[model samples]
Target: MSIRITGLRGENRIGDGHNHKGRKVTSAPSSIGFYLYGALLLLVCALKIPALVRRPRDTLLRAACLLLLSAGLLMILAAPHSIAGLNRHSGIANVSAPVVYVMTTIFSGASLLLIINWRPAPAEQTRRLTRLCLVLYGAASLAIVLLFWAGDAPVEQRTLFDVHYAGTPCIREMIVLYLGAQGAAMTAASVMCWRWSAKVRGSLRAGLTILAVAYLLIVCFVVMRLCAVAARWTGHDLDFLVDEVSVLLSAPAAVLGALGFALPLAGPRLAETVRAIRQLRQLGPLWRALKDVPTPGAVRVPLSWWRNPPAVLLTGRKTALYDAILALTPHCDPEVRDAAHAAALRAGCGDADAARAAEAAMILVARERQRASPLRPPDATGREVRHAQAQDLITLSRAVTSPLVHHIRDPYMPLQKAANHE
Candidate 1:
């Protein structure tokens, strides 16, 4: 009987549906996980809407994210119905199948949009890798979509579709493609994040770490899904197992994807939280410093300074403690410069020829520096002028600067030397 054959197929599709259900008697836990993931997706969408409203420049990215969430939401709704044992009604079957199909299409569209719109960053090699990944995923999705559309049967009527609401071979392929794209995007974002995170201190770094972990989780799930698909295509008869495993994996992957995008937006909040926690432990040091405020301490610093060279000299708190960090122009030992030159040579440079070229380049830079409008010391008559200088020094000390010159400590011995001298 056809009924017997279909039942046998269904049984074979998931090993033992009854046993699977018995293993998890209630779907409540699964439902909760799905709900959480759905909520996260919606929240990300909600966050992006306002961002789009505020910055029109992000229209394309915002639109892509919105489309992604919408497609995911429809799939989530249809997933449970197909996973359940109930026979599809005329209305539900007709509408749900098309919805799933549309969801896959939307996924491909959104991914392509993201790829086409990606802006490259500094590292040309890394950017090329990223672009290549995006292109491969996009091309695969396009191939899958074309196959699905050109196939004899609608994807909904396929045996694979009966096993899960997800589109059959085509849908599975799309899932792999989408996941690959996301993994690549996440990697690229992580690379971009690294350069910026170093400039940030305290809680900001923690937030970035959390995001990186989330991105890694996303990549893991995507890889797992790819493995599952591969296993099925190899005629392993483990389609049921793959489907079940994929169901278990999808929600967490979705949760992590949402978290990765959301947490970075709250970086300032997390930073404040970290700062508050640190302040509690640092209260004693702070109280002591406040207690010693009237001690009239004098800190020694060099009289003349070049801002560029000295900025590199003092590593951490040395410049923080000293009010004015003097940058002495070309005053460092020639041996140190020579060592640096040697290092540069070892890093791919000719001997005297490269050194001469470097010297000529430095000379050109110095000559160009001659054209800069020199800062005139403010007239001390106005309080405003003095206040401006105070603010400027604070800004200079705290700012993140490029590394072109190295800073060195003044070797001259003073009458009183600090115990922590480097």
Candidate 2:
């Protein structure tokens, strides 16, 4: 058997084994298309299950996803000739195939319209278009049922193609009416989805942008198909070009649909990587400044300089120890906090004096947020609380690094630095 347009039978439209037998034995690559399309549809369904069950914040997005998956599955089912033949042949036939066809047409068309007529924020538009597509599908189903009752034959035999010219004017009118309504709805939906990409970030934005383009491509594909079909009726040469273009376009739409539908998973990871880089940059300069500060042992011969530096070097009344720890606190990771604490102590207090020195540092750190810099140590009572909080943060920080502490440098005098730094 040879392929025939629905309800149209012409000449053999076939000749040799190459045209008929070879083609018949191999069939088209519909199964492969079905597998890929079906897998994508199933994956989309899997993703939506959590959204549908939990009712995610983006409920409209979840619903659009479900609609797209259903449309894709309909297209996949339409791909196989055996399935198409079965739909045509099933007596007492269900209206499911035609209903699916109409639904798919409406969704694909509305998705493109939403893209082309995009606004600054597409959220409202997308929601409206989605609802419109749903409404159109519902209205089309109702019309199909009415047509079934008033038909010359069963619903299976009364396809839209047949209804287009069936002598009953109301049947033809309803088919045309519903098809127009479906197309208009799909176009609107596509435009909204395309516009909504503006709010997304990083890879999510990229995927949405690509999805917008893909949706537009699908719209263009359908428009081109309709134009070619019309031209063919009028005996034009554009039909072959339309078929070739559609085949080329369909691949990307399918691929992009699969990729876009996976964005919820892909987007967050991309955003995380970006955030990590920003955190590093925000802290990088401070770490670099710490690296360049001279060790106190290399320079300090005056015990009085340790007790009292020039106001210029000290930068007001705060000690260098106060300045160093304050700067390091925000960036100090578990691996580096001990080193930072040690550096703070060595720059001002020796290892033998670490506990006393740490108490002093704690006093200064407590006053850090209140004053522009550390001043004279807090009073004894304030010192007690300061020491406790500092010890807690540092102790917890050090415990976190205990297994890896061997790789860490102690303040200056190794053993005591290890013991008291905590």
Candidate 3:
């Protein structure tokens, strides 16, 4: 059960316990990498915890938060310094080994549960398979604890503990149990995500694709560790694979998985923000033109110090525009719209642009008429106007400031002037 390092010259020998032919083994690089990965997972936990608390009945969000929190805790505990401290505080030799193994197994089970809840299959089938996975992994975790409890390893090698004591009594069984559970979870996650990625679109598809790659890397980490353990039984050393290669793989795997889970939830909100900003910019000209008209108290300006200006402006602009349109409905003239449409067509505008320009011209004339007469009763026989859609308002907004619309409105200005002269 003695650990031996393989030399560069292809010789198996026991040198200074921490070195292979005078090369010192160090966990500093891996420790830093693990810490960064753990920090990111903790940040994700921080972001999701509030949402989970807000929607306590949302099973999907709760499961995802639990998975992230557990993974973060596991990474922190598995770091080199934390592992040594844990062993020291427990007063039991190699006690950290069992603790880390149990945590890793639990995290793996949690990850599988997250995926299962994310994209569930038929109700009965999904429930049955989910139950089966939980029971199997639960049993595997129990076996890991039992085996580690029976094992004895005096030396504390936090970074390479599994590799160093692979052949020791009961330690081999513990490693096998952990690797088996992790490997199974990774395999299922990779397949499920890859298959679903192709079926989806936009951010969800990209997230699933990234998740698939992350799971594949985790699978490689598990396979490499298992090979190192198996190599011990065959009198061949593959410690470098477990110590060096797997560390490199695991860090990126954790990071990519965390990002993959985050993208779908965050992407939509980001898009909505961009859309709101654009709408605020687009509605500026129309909103300003209608601002002079006095509307009811319900259309008061949305002044807020805390909210984003563009989002607040968008809400305020929509409300004001709707109110202005309702007020101008009584003054709308069909003949004026027909004349403006013809004028727009003569100005080299296309059919759709001419129609929008016509609508803008009629609205401008109505605004002027409303300004002249303080109050006007609703016309019973006035042409019924359909409520303008958001897209219609955007089209009118664009045409409102166009030169062609102004040209059409210019002819009607003489009438307002003549009425004033009287």
What C-alpha lDDT values do all the predictions have?
A: 0.40, 0.45, 0.73
* Candidate 1 local Cα displacement, residue 323, angstroms: 24
Instruction: Flag regions of model 2 displaced more than 4 Å.
Output: 1-27, 43-47, 50-62, 81-100, 109-132, 141-186, 198-201, 274-422
Candidates sorted by TM-score, descending order? 3, 2, 1
All candidates: TM-score: 0.43, 0.50, 0.81
Candidate 3's TM-score reads: 0.81
User: Candidate 1, residues 159-252: lDDT per residue as tens digits?
Assistant: 2442342345555554454445555655555554555567666545554555455545545544555564566566444444333544454445
Which residue pairs in candidate 3 have backbone atoms (N, alpha carbon, C) closer than 3 angstroms, thus clashing?
none
TM-score between candidate 1 and the true structure: 0.43
Could you tell me the lDDT of residue 271 within candidate 1? 58
- Candidate 1, residue 164: how far the Cα is off, in Å: 9.5
The regions of model 1 sitting more than 4 angstroms off are 1-36, 47-51, 59-68, 71-75, 82-146, 152-234, 277-422
The 10-residue segment of model 3 with minimum total lDDT is 1-10
- For candidate 3, lDDT tens digit of each residue in 303-381? 6636655566677778778877776777777678889999989988898898889888888887887787756645624
Instruction: Give the alpha carbon lDDT tens digit for every residue of 266-294 in model 2.
Output: 77765665554454444343333333333
Runs with alpha carbons beyond 4 Å of true place in candidate 3: 1-18, 26-62, 231-237, 296-298, 308-313, 369-391, 414-422
